[model samples]
Target: MRAVIATEPGGPEVLTVAELPDPEAGPGEVVLDVAAAGLNRADLLQRMGFYPPPPGASDVMGMECSGTVAAVGPDVEGWSVGDRACALLAGGGYATKVAVPAGQLMPIPDGVDLVTAAALPEVACTVWSNVFMVAGLQPGEAFLVHGGAGGIGTMAIQLASELGAKVFTTGGTAEKLAACAALGADVTINYRDEDFVEVIREVTDGRGVDVILDNMGAKYLGRNVDTLATEGRLVIIGMQGGTRAELDINALLRKRGAIIATTLRSRPTAEKSAICASVVEHVWPLVAEGLVQPIVHGTMPLAEARAAHALMESGDHMGKILLTT
Candidate 1:
């Protein structure tokens, strides 16, 4: 198997492709012949030594991949060799072959191809679990997500809009904002110039949003609270803007709002399985009907992991970036 490994804690230059031993399926697991891997911000964090894989998991830098089952281990059911799937993973996606827990695999939706399927698992699971399952966004409500043109943002915008919520998003560039609008974002704000909180408030006529899917952690915490409608819910999944911001408990109490912070990578297998099941039951139908779709910005050979990482870090791409094996 050929896999991308980090030589040390550093920049994209530390990534290199090398031949490595093929992984085998363990109990309740399966080995996949990987078709493609999705590049995520977490991968870059792992490469820079800011994030590390959970205990008893692969150290490779990827959180999801699309592939075929090559081997199924004992205790696994409803799967066998030759099955095609896209999986949410804890690690080890940047390779020609990788092992995954059986419960993490999700069947590809009707209109999606193998390589593009690689882009769905993480974003779909992340957005579905956080925005709907946790935040409980309702139809006819208002919702906002930061970084609207990125992988998770794209999926969140489409799904929220399709489900009848008015969608709001923030982007740094015109092209990115326009791309987001094409995907169903109702209000697109340029975070570089306009204030998202103010824009959202004005758009809703002084009533803020009912739910917010925010990745910008502490930097937006206060404003996110200020942007919330009474009894609103805010779900935070990333800390790209830094962690540890002060909270205005009085304001939150006054509005009766709730805030939640979570991560998909560290969840137990059973929880991930539940999230996958809900996604298949709820999200997949929309995807199959073409109400929601994967937004792939580009693809590169697996060996070009370094370039992919650089491109993702540059933040110039509008959607998911895939590395094909």
Candidate 2:
């Protein structure tokens, strides 16, 4: 098998494709002949030595993939050899063959092809768990997501809007904002030129938004609180801005808001399995019905993963970047 590994923590140039031993399925797991892998910001962070995979996981850089089942281990049922599936992985997706827990596997959605299915698992589970399960976003409420044109943001906007929430999002350019609007975002703010907090407040008649899905962490912490409606929920899933910030306890208390910071990669396998199940039950139907879709920017060969990483870091792509084996 060939896998991409970082020689050392640094730039995209550090990554190289090399021969590695093929993986075999363990109990309750399945071995996949990977068709394609999705590129994520976390992959870049791992390459730079800022993020490491959880203990006992693979060091190869990838979080999600779609492939065919080449083998299944003992205790696994309802899946078999030759099945086409996509999975959310803890690591090791940038390879020709990888082993995954059977519970993390999902059949490709009705309308999506096998290769494009690679783009769904990570973004779907992330948005569904944080926005609906944790934040409890309800119909008719106002929802806001930062980085509206990226993978998670694009999925969040469509899902929230389809479920009856009035969606708001922030992007850095007109083209990005336009893409968000076409995906059902009711309000789009250019973060480069406008204050999102004020824009959100004005759009909602000063009541603010009921839920906010944020990726900027410390950079937007204070402003996110200011933009939340009373009893609002704010979920932070990324730290592109920084990790530390001061909180205005009084402001949060006055609004009765809740702040939660979370990451998907470190979660226990059982929890991830449960989230995958929930996504299949609640979100897959929307995708099958054409109400939501995977937004992929482009696809590259697995050996070109370094170029994919460079593109993601450039922030020029509008959606997910994929690497095909």
Candidate 3:
């Protein structure tokens, strides 16, 4: 097997691919001959040594991949060699092969090809678990997601719209905002020129939004709270902005709003499996029906993972970037 590793904690230049021994499946796990791996913000953080995998997970940077099952461990069931699947992983996805817990594997939605399936696991599981499962976003509610043209944002826009929420998103450029609107964003704010809080406030007739999926962390915290409707939920999944911030408890109390900060990478396996199962049940049907879809920007060879990381860091690409084996 071949894998990408950071020679040192620094820039994308530190990444290098090297030959390594193939991983063996453990109890209740399976090994995949990877078809493609998805680039994520977390992968860049891992490469820079800010986010390490949980204990015993491989040091590879990827958190999701699509592949064929190559081996299954004892106690694993309902999967076998040659099974085509996409997987959520704790690590080890930036390789030609990876070991995944059996429960985290998902069948490809009808009509999605093998490689594009790599784009679904992380975004689907993250959005479904955080927005619907935890935040309890319901039909007729208003929803907002930051970075509307990125991997998670695109998926969030489509899913929230398809599920009957009035979707709102923030993007930096005309092209990106247009894309988000086409993907069903009812309101698109140019974060550079317009304040999302004001835009959301005006569009919701000052009721504000029922839910907000924020990635900017501290940079948007105060405003996010201001934008939330009474009893609204704000879920923060990334700290792309600086982490530390002061909270306005009195303001939150007035609205009875809730704020939650979470990460998908560090979740317990059983919890992740449950999220995957729920996604299959609730999200896959919409995907198969063509009401929701994966947004892939482009593909690069697995060996060029360094370039892929650079592209993501540049923040110039729209949608998910994949590394194909």
Candidate 4:
């Protein structure tokens, strides 16, 4: 098997391809012949030594992949060799072969290709778990998302709209916001030009949004609270802008709002599998119907993982960057 390994913590240049032994499925697990892998911010972080793989998990950097089942472990049911699937992984997706718990594997939705299926597991699971499961975005209510053109943002906009939420999002450019709007955002704020808090307030007649999906943690913390309706939920999934911040507890109490911060990769296997199961049952049909398609920015060969990382760092992509085997 061929796998991308980071020899040391540095730039993407440190990533290299090497021959590795094929991984075998353990109890309740399945070995996948990885067809494609999707890039995430965490992949870059792990490559540079900021985030490490979970304890007792694969050392590889990828967190999600789409492929065919090459083998199934003892006691694993509901899946078998040759099943087309995508899976959310604890780690080890950046390879020709990787093993994942069977519960984490989702059958590829009808009409979706193997490579495109790679793009869905992470974004679908992330958006479903955070925006719907945790934050409880409701139909006809205002929903705001930061990083509106990234993979998670693109998926969030579509899924939120499909579920009937009036979506709002912040991007760095007019083109980016336009792309987000095309995906179903009712209000698009250019964070570089407009104050999103003010824009969101003005758009909603000063009442504020009912739910906000944020990736800029510390930087947007104060304003996020300012742009929330009573009982509004703020779900923070990433800290791209910085981590530490000052918050006004009184303001939050006044709004009767709640803030939640979570990461999918760090979750326990059982919880992740549960999220995967629900997404397969509920969201996969949307893909099958073409109502919620994964937006792929580009596909690059797996050996050029550094170039993929460079493209993500440039912030020029409108959706996902995929690495194919």
Count of residue pairs whose backbone atoms collide, per candidate: 0, 0, 0, 0
List candidate 4 segments past 4 Å from native: none
Instruction: Put the candidates in lDDT order, highest first.
Output: 2, 1, 3, 4
* Model 2 lDDT tens row, 126-236: 999999999999999999999999999999999999999999999999999999999999999999999999998788899999999999999999999999999999999
- Candidate 2 or 4, higher lDDT? 2
List TM-score per model, in order: 0.99, 0.99, 0.99, 0.99
Tens-place lDDT per residue, model 3, 1-325, is: 9999999999999999999999999999999999999999999988899999999899888999999999999999899899999999999999999999998999999999999999999999999999999999999999999999999999999999999999999999999999999999998999999998888878778999999999999999999999999999999999998898999999999999999988888889999999999999999999999999999999999889889999999999999999999
The global C-alpha lDDT for each of the candidates, from Candidate 1 onward, is 0.95, 0.95, 0.95, 0.93
The clash number for model 1 is 0
Q: In candidate 1, which residue ranges exceed 4 Å CA deviation? A: none
The whole-model C-alpha lDDT of candidate 4 against the native structure comes to 0.93
Off by over 4 Å in 2: none
- The stretch of ten residues in a row with the least summed lDDT in candidate 3 is 196-205
Of models 1 and 3, which has the larger lDDT? 1
